[model samples]
Target: MTDSTAPRVAIVTGASGGIGRAVAERLAADGVRVVAHYSGNADAAAEVVAAITAGEGEAIAVGGDVADEAAMAALFDAAEQRFGGVDVLVHTAGIMPLGPIAELDLETFDRIQRVNVRGTFVVDQLAARRMRSGGAIINFSTSVTRLQMPTYGAYAASKGAVEAMTLILARELRGRDITVNAVAPGPTATPLFFAGKPQEVVDRIASLNPMERLGTPEDIAEVAAFLAGPGRWVNGQVLYANGGAA
Candidate 1:
C-alpha cells in the first residue's frame, strides 16, 4: 500500500501536448509529482515541465516511444527512481488515422494497432506490476466508439480493444486496490484532431454535441484528475467525456 501522506507520483504518457499535457499539469497542481512522457517533441515536453515548475509543481520530461517496451520500462524506472513509487498512470499516447475501412491499407491498420493497442498493453502491464496499492490506471479511448462515425472505423476498433483490456484488467487486479478505467473523449480541440480537418467539418462535428463546442484538453484533464484521485469506486468502466455527442 502507498503511504497516503507521501506526495503521489504519476507517469502521464503523451504529455507533450493535447489532453496528455493538460492531464499532467492538472495532476501536478493536485500535488502529484509528474513524469511527463513524450515521443518526439522534446522541446514541447520541456515546456510542459517548465509550466509545472513555474506553477511550483514538480515535473520532469521523459522521452520514449509508447510502443517500445524497453523505452516504457525505462520510463517507469525513472518515475520510481525519482518519486519513490508510481501511484498513477494515465496513458494518453496513441495515433488516430481517419480513413474509410474499405480503403484503409493493411500497413496503416497495423501501425494503428501497434501503437494504440500494443502500447496500452505494454504500459498497463508495467503499471499493473509495479504500482503500489491505492493506485489508478487510466487509458485513453475515443468517444467515436459510441459515436460510430463513418471514417472513424479503424481508430474506433483500436479503442475498442483498449476498452476491453481496461475492464478485464480491473477485474484481474482483484485485491490490488487499484482502479482501472478508460476515458473516451469526444472531439477535443487538439492538434491531432484538427489535422486534415476543414473548419466547416470541425464546426459540424462540434454542433453534434448538445454543448455545441469541441471539448478542450483541460476538460478531459479534469475527468482524468478525478479518476486518479477520489474516483476509486469507478473501476471497470469507460467514462465518455464527450459532452453528449454520441
Candidate 2:
C-alpha cells in the first residue's frame, strides 16, 4: 500500500522493456510511485504495470515518444497530475544503432542521436525544472563510451553526450540535494542486442567483459535503484556497473 504522502514520484522513459522496465519495477518496489513511459508498446507497458502492481508496487503506464518534445512535456504533465510533482527521473529511452562509421548512414546516425542524446536532454531538463528538493536523476550511458568499440562510434557518441550532461547537471544541482548520475552497463542480455544477433556473435560480445557473462536488466536495475534511493553522497558519478568491464 502506498502512502498518500509518499515523496518519491518517478518518471521512467523507454519503460516497455530492458533496463527501463526493470528500473521502473524496482523503484516501485522501493515504494516510489512510478510512471512507466513507452513509445508504442502498450501491451508490454501494461505487462510491466501488472507485474509491478502484482508485486504490490504502485505504477502506471504512459505512452509517448521520448524524442518528441511536446509528447515529453505532456508525459510529465500527466504524471504530475496523477502522482504529484516529479521527484525522480530515469531516462532509459535510447537507441543503440551500431554499425561501422563508414557504413553508418546519416539517417541512422541522426535517429540514434535524436532518441539517445536529445531525448535525454529533454527529460533531464524537465526533471531539473520540477524535481522536488533532494530528488535524483539517473541517465543511462554505455560501457562502450570507455571500451570505444569499433562498431559503436555513433552510439557511443550519444552516450558520451549523456555523460557530459549528467556531470554538468550534478554541479548545477549541487545545493538542491538532487544527485545526478549515470549508469554505464556493458553487454546486457536484453533483446536490445541479443535477439537479432548471431549466436556466435552474441557469445563473443558477452565474453568480451571480464565477468565472462552478460549483464542482466535486473543487474543494472539494482544499481539504478540504489542511486535513485539512498546513494546521495554518490553524486556526479557514472557508476560503471559493467562487472569489471571497461
**Candidate with the greatest TM-score versus the true structure:** 1
Give Cα-based local distance difference scores for all models. 0.96, 0.89
Off by over 4 Å in 2: 1-7
- Tens-digit lDDT track for model 2 on 69-100? 78999999988899877888988888887899
Error of 1 at 112 (Å): 0.4
* Total colliding residue pairs, candidate 1: 0
lDDT at 160, model 1? 99
Per-prediction TM-score: 0.99, 0.95
Q: Backbone collision count in every prediction?
A: 0, 0
> Measured by TM-score, how close is model 1 to the native structure?
0.99
Among the numbered candidates, top lDDT falls to: 1
* Angstrom error at residue 181, model 2: 0.5
